[model samples]
Target: MSARVAVLGLGAMGLPMATALARIFDVVAFDIAAERVALAVEAGATGVGTVVEACLGTDVVVVGVRDGAQLDALVLGDGGVADSLPTGAVVVVTSTVGEAAVRAVAEALAARGIRCVDAPVSGGPVRAGTGDLLIMVGADDEALAAARPVLDALSSSLTVVGGIGAGQQLKTVNQLLCGIHTAAASEALALAHRLGLDLDACIEVLSQGAAASFMFADRGPRIAAQLRGETPPLRSRLDVIGKDMGIVGDLARQLKVATPVAAAAEQLYRTVAAAGLDASDDSVVATMLAKEPAW
Candidate 1:
């Protein structure tokens, strides 16, 4: 029989991920939002009202929380799912919470004879629904084996980074580049708009040339659309990227690394958040930057 899976926290990423896993496994989904749970059921997965209910008989639990605090609250201490999960069941963390946080959770889960797979994923909602994400994993052989089927169903590229916490470490590195690229893309596109050039043509050219980056390719059109005063759907929110940038900063400080560029990007995200755009799509940064005197 296929490994029974439970997906927790069905937000933007979690919902699509649940849908993808449902295609291959007996997926049970849970979220705080009733609407989200209903949507998961519509996507061919059983919907549970609570984390405990979702993980009761599941072999693997996939968590997609917003940050370390949520992840901790959901799986550790009193009334957490760790107490409810079966011994030897694996918990795959797909959030980009920090290394230390994941390590703490892993250690806690290990004490219960449960396994934790630190697998932070990249790629947006569309890629997630298609099972084409890039997953960075940090776990021992046994734990990895326990979660391999779920991870494989969710990822097109899965790289084993190291022991527990390494996935979060590498994901921090990945977010550093992503955060910086997003800031740079906004700045460059804002400049292009100011230069009286064809923004679409410029984006097309830059995306094909030395200036090319995945952020530019993925978020570029959205940036251009924002320039046209159109509201792009909130695929990735400003606060989400801002939160990742904050994680990058925290990790850099712990390592005592000087990341002036990433720091700058982090500040840019802060500015956008301060402008009350935290709930908006991150592409709105391009719009905010293209304004007069560019904050």
Candidate 2:
């Protein structure tokens, strides 16, 4: 029999992973939002009412919550699923929380002999639904062995970074680059618009040259369209990146890493959030960028 799996949290990223895992396992999904649960059920997985209900007797639990505080509450706080998991069951935390936070959660689960992996992921929701995610994992060999099926089901590119907390550590660096690239891409496109250039042609040329970046290819067109007042597909949310970049900042401060580019990018995300685009897609950063320069 396939490993019985439960996917806790069915938001944008979580829902897609849940649906993809459902194709190969006995997957049950849970979330606070009724609409989200409804969507998961429609996608072929059973939806459960509570986290406890979702994890009861499961072999593995895949967590895809929003941030550290929420992940803490879900795994260690009241009604937390960690307390409910059977010994030997693995918990895979795919949230991009800090290494420190993931270590704390892993240590707690180890006390119960319930293995945990700090596995942060990249690629957006579409890649998640297709099991094409880029997954970075941190776990011992045994725990990794136990979690392999679930990991394989959700990733096209997978690497075991190190033990216990290394995955989140790498993820912090990953977000550092992501934030810088996103901020820079938005600024460049916004500048092009200010110059009255052919937006589509500009994007095409930039993508073909050394100036191109993954963020430019992935978010550039959406940013262009969003500037024209079109609502693009929700691949990533600003509030999510706002939260991720905040983790990156905290890590940088703790380790005394100078991050001028990332700090500047973080500030742009802050300004965008203040303008009420947090719930919108990250491409909405272009809206804030396309305004008159203060200088």
Candidate 3:
């Protein structure tokens, strides 16, 4: 039998994921933004006004909001999903929230006899639409088994990381690497421009060599466009990476581990965000580098 799934938060990633889930399950999608809810509905999802209403009678509830606080509001606040979920239903928290927050939510849901899975995902909206996201799931054996099919419907790669909070722990590491790599790519491109090299050829050659990275290949064109004053499509925002890296910083502090590269990358992103370019694509950081005063 198909699972009855309720997807909350119909944002860039969530909307596409919910739409995919609707194809195989009875999906009721909800969002704080009515426009997003409307979009999901138009994409064949059933739109609901509230999170609680969406979770009602569902076999699994997917919470894809922005952060820990938003996840708490959806699951533990007044008329939250926990309050509305039928007993034995599973609650999947797919936000890129940190480990501690996932632990707290998992414990709270467990008290109410609702299984909770911290299944944070990688890959952006485009991958989510194609059901090719990388899902790092954190749950016990039974919960993992119960949630596997739902996750399989949305992800091309699903890894069952140990227990509660493991998925988020892994995602934190992923964000750290992402921040560092993006910063490195930005710096390399800026240096290439400053050296009076042909920017396109420089990128093409570097991308074919040992210096190449996913961030370089994916964001290189966008970085070049920012240098040329053309805004690229919004894929990943500077503020979003800043937020993720900030979470990584917090995790590092809690674990007493020093992440110097991630710290430097975080500062660059914070600078971009503070300069009122938070909503711009992360490649815009190259613009900041290009405008720096000569020292």
**Residues 1-295, candidate 3, lDDT per residue (tens digit)?**
4678889988768999998887888889999899989898888889989877898789888888878888888889999987999888898888898888889988988899999999999888888987899999889987777777789999999998789999999999988988898999899888887787888898899999999987788889888888878888877878778989999999899889989989999999998899899988899999889876987
Against the reference, the lDDT scores of all candidates come to 0.92, 0.89, 0.87
Positional deviation of residue 126's Cα in model 1 after best superposition, in angstroms: 1.4
Instruction: Report the lDDT tens digits of candidate 2 across residue range 44-160.
Output: 888999988888999999999998888899999877877889999999999898888889999888998899988999987889999999999999999999999899999999999
Off by over 4 Å in 1: none
Question: Which residue pairs show collisions in model 2?
Answer: none
On lDDT, the candidate that comes out on top is 1
Of the two candidates 2 and 3, the one with more favorable lDDT, higher being better, is 2
Work out candidate 3's RMSD over C-alphas: 1.8
- The parts of candidate 3 lying over 4 Å away from their true place are 195-198, 292-295
TM-score of each: 0.96, 0.96, 0.93
For candidate 1, the per-residue lDDT at 285 reads 96
Greater-TM-score candidate between 1 and 3: 1
Off by over 4 Å in 2: 293-295
Candidate 1 lDDT (Cα, whole model)? 0.92
> How many clashes show up in model 1?
0
